[model samples]
Target: MSQATPPRSRRVPRAERREEILAAAARVFGSKGYRAGSLAEVAEQVGITHAGVLHHFGSKDRLLWEVLEYRDRVDVEHLEGQHIPGGLELFRHLVTTARRNADRRGIVQAYTVLTGEAVTDGHPAADRARTRFGVLREDIASALRTVADERGVDLAEQDAVRAASAVIGVMDGLQTQWLLDPEVVDLAESTAFAIEAILRAVLPGVEPLPDSPGASGAP
Candidate 1:
């Protein structure tokens, strides 16, 4: 007996289909690396033809950027869903994100591999990676300042910027360490520990961190 093959149509809604394509592309690129990933492969994964994939993305490079942007949005969404009462809390968020990244191996691979390739001039996601990190710093800095306002302590602009940058740097650095040795780093736990040490610096007069990063689980 012959089985029915589902028809491919734009009926899934353009935006949703685009997300599906981007998610599939991320997994493929994460596994194969950008240069090695091809439209044919992505199409195969999406249950479509190469032409069908190009119809939505124009080209493989465009598809890659969409995947990066998707990841960036997810990252921002995670932070948006939480409240960090002080600068140290922001650190806690970053550290917890590191832990979550470690737990989700595929995402960690996708982010690390794409960013590594992104450093090359003219790489499709190079500008996006730069913009994404800059925006992330701004978001965290804003929250830190809010904490400062609440505490009635005004840190110098340089201090806030430095603190935000330091948090981002530590996260990126720790992610790499965790990637290299998950057993040794256990990124999430280590993140909480590291950020806990910085608590005194950022929350000088604020109430202490809750028993568990304000009830957020898995970063």
Candidate 2:
């Protein structure tokens, strides 16, 4: 006899459910921008109630910060244990990052929006933006130092700092352009060219980065 068919289970582990909420938030916030994004939309996407999303994040502001942190965490994981001392390896990794971003436009857009919004007088992510930029510059400077030391080149600390800032600026700008008109700007190729050009000018004997689909010949 076909007895009782058990009911379909609808349970998710806490960690997995939280991740699902964050993913939904990222997509909603990415598409609508922070100010316009709503927890209700995220809840709908996750098949949970608005309160459920809040149960994981507490508030919309907190959720935004969590989403940003998630983006950074993903990026860090991508580079973990690579042990890239400096120079070409760094550029190669940066290019790879851009390529990965091409397929994850939502993540890219979310960060871009948060960056713009964070520039206001008071914003939930202002501190995070400040800390993130500081850390990014230090990491980039470390790469520059590693290359300089290995090649017996003399690069002033200030120069490395400036170069690091320039690298981030170029990358962010390229990302903005790419988002607006992907046909006009190939993020990975343009970013590779920009970074390689800076390296060649500042550090002689820097080996050329390999050819990539977007990188035409570096100038």
Candidate 3:
């Protein structure tokens, strides 16, 4: 005798469905680090079976990468869009993105755990992490270069890269700090403070010429 096909409920649209699954993965991984998280739980969160989840994403690692990719996409969509960030708004975006890292602990855990594991030379996320950071660093450096141009200040690409590294370091360092002591931070404010200092050092006339807009100064 032939077996009957399982009944199919209404299906969400493909892209929407993918995003929903990724969202669930983020929540699950946030609660239980990547290795400890199960495809089963992710499927359950999305009201589907483990096989259904695998059918969409193939495996746990694939799903994890999607989550990471999604976060990166979100960053680009907001921070580096056609709307060029400038003035205090640019600083706010920098500080805000850094602060937002705290809310993305699963991504941070994946980064930290992967970086630690990468020391073994042939670990799973080793090359992926290395490439990811390199691209991220370059993008940040490019943004800083733009900011410097907007302020009419010329900076060497090396200087731009160094500033970019320092800014990215704040986010990475803050993630490490918060994972150790969540209570000790107000990430938004702390990041603002850090970037403000960095800006003061790098942006020249803009820093000291305060207390009044157009305060006998020009960028």
Q: List the residue pairs that clash in candidate 3.
A: none
Model 2 TM-score is 0.77
Give TM-scores for every candidate, taking all chains together and pairing residue i with residue i.
0.72, 0.77, 0.73
lDDT of each: 0.66, 0.75, 0.66
Which regions of candidate 1 are displaced past 4 Å? 1-10, 26-45, 58-64, 75-93, 121-124, 205-219
Q: List, residue by residue over 1-219, the lDDT tens digit for candidate 3.
A: 012212247567778778878878877787687678788877777777889888889887778877877766665464445342544455555555555566666666766665566658677767777887787677666766776788788878777777767877776676667777778976556666666666656666554212122112111
Number of the candidate with higher TM-score, 2 or 3: 2
Local accuracy of candidate 1 as per-residue lDDT tens digits, 1-219: 012222455366767767777767866775665567677877776667888788999987667667766765664454545333344455555655565565456556556766788999898778888997888778777877877777788667777777777767777777778878878987777766655555446657555444333335543
Ten residues in a row with the worst lDDT in model 3? Answer: 210-219
For lDDT, candidate 1 versus 2, the one ahead is: 2
Tens digits of per-residue lDDT, candidate 2, 86-194, equal 5556766677667666666766776787788898998867898899889878888888888898888999988899988988888888989998999999987898888
List ranges where model 2 is wrong by over 4 Å: 1-16, 26-41, 59-61, 78-87, 210-219
lDDT of 2 at 131: 91
Weakest 10 consecutive residues, lDDT, candidate 2? 1-10
